[model samples]
Target: MLSDRRLFLLTLGSASLASLAACASGPQRVERPMNGDFPGIPFADWTDQEPEYLLYPGDEIEVATPTASELTRTVRIGPDGRIALPLIGSVMAADRTLPQLQQVVSAAYAPQLVRPTVEVTLRQAGPIRVWVDGEVRTPGVFEMIGDLDAYQAVIQAGGFAPTSRQDSVALIRRGPGGSRMMRVVDLRPRRGEVVPLRRGDIIFVPRSTLGELAAFFTQVRAALPIGFSYSINGSNGSGFAQF
Candidate 1:
C-alpha cells in the first residue's frame, strides 16, 4: 500500500495538467445566472464564466437542521457519501448539488415532515490545497483561496529563478475525465497570460519539459529522507534516535 505522504506527493505530481489547462484555457469572466431565491456568485472570478467554485468529489455539507417535527428528526450524511437517516439508508450523495440534495432528503421525508424547509450547509469543506514543486525558488504548498490564479501560485512560490524552466511551468488539476495534463500559455514573464489555479492542484516549475519527469523523481527521492527524518525528530527529538 502507498504511504500517505507518497499519495499526497503523487496527487501533487500528477495535477500539473489542470494548471496547464487553466493557463491554456485562458481566464474567462461573465455573469452568474439566478436560481430562484438562491444567490449567485459573480462570474468575474471564473474561466469562460464557469461556476465560481468548481464542485469536487468529497465536498461536505451540513444542514442547520429543522425542528423535530419539521424534519425526519436528525438525519445526517457522512463524508463517505453514506447516510443513515430516520428511515432512508445509505444513498450516494456524490455529484448532486446542494439544492438537489435538499430536495432528495426532503422528498424522502415528505411522508413525515411538512413542506420540509431544507437548508444545505457545507459542514467540512473539502481539501483545497495547491502544491508547487521543482526548480522554483521556494516550491511548496499553498492554500487555495478566493479567485486564485495561476500567476498567483507561481508568485507565492517566491517567484521563478533565472535558470527557471519558464516555459514548462506545469499546473495540474483534476476533472470528470480522470485528469488532463497540458502545456498552458508559455510562462514567459510579463506575457500577461496564465490562468487561475484551483484547489487540489499541483504546479511544477521544471528546468525544461524534456526531463521534468526525471527531475521530479530525483527531487522526491532526495526530499523523502529529509522529510521523514524531520517528522520523526520533530515528534521526539532525542527519543527518535533511542528507538
Candidate 2:
C-alpha cells in the first residue's frame, strides 16, 4: 500500500492526466465577428457630433435656479459620484446627463418651491479614465472625457506599435446586465468614423498575424515533453524518473 503522501500525489497526477486527455484536441479559438463599428455602443446618431456629456466624478458644474440664485453655485462631483447641495443634501450625479441631472435637482426641490427652474451647465470637465492595453506605445489606464473616441484614445496612448494588428482592435465593454462583451473594431483610417468610446472601457490592440504565429510556437515549445517516466517499486523508494 502507498503512503498517504504518495496516494495524494497519485490522485493529483491522475486528475491532471485526465484533464490533459480532455484537452488533447487543443485550444479551439472562437471566431468572433469583425466589423467597422463597435457593438453595444449606440452609434446610429454618432458622428463627430458631441455626446450629451454625463456627469462623472471630478466634474465641475454650476446649478442655476432662476428664482433662487442662492442655490446657484459651482460644485465638484465627489469621488463617490455624489454632490452636496444646501437643500437637497447629497445627490447622485455620476452617469447622469446634464438634462437628467437638472430634472433630479428640480424634483428634489419641488417641495420647497412651487416650481423650481433648475439649469445645470458643465463648468469644466474632469478626469475620466479608460484602460488601453496591448500593442500600443503606452499600454495602461488613461484619463479622458466623453467626446474621446477609440481612435483618439489609442493615439493618446502613444499610437499603435509596430506589432499591433490595426485591423482588429478589441473593445471590451461591460453591458448593463453585468456581462462583458468584446467587439473587434477595424481601426483603419477612414473619413467620418464616428464610433465613440465610453468611460471604463478596455481597448486592446491585438498583436499582428506574425506575432500570433510566434506565440503559438512558444506555447508548443513550453508544452512539448522530451522524456518522462514514473513507477512504483515494491518496498524500495518510489520510482520516478525524467529527462
Q: Which candidate has the highest lDDT of all?
A: 2
Model 2 residue 19 lDDT score? 29
Give candidate 1 misplaced runs (Cα > 4 Å). 1-49, 52-61, 64-96, 103-118, 122-129, 144-147, 161-163, 174-183, 192-194, 199-201, 215-243
lDDT of each: 0.50, 0.61
- List the candidate 2 regions with Cα displacement exceeding 4 Å: 1-50, 134-138, 144-166, 172-183, 186-201, 207-243
lDDT of 2 by residue, 92-168 (tens): 88778888999999999999877798999998877667777667998766777548888888899899898776655
Candidate 1 to truth, TM:
0.46
Best by TM-score: 2
Q: How well does model 1 score by local distance difference test? A: 0.50
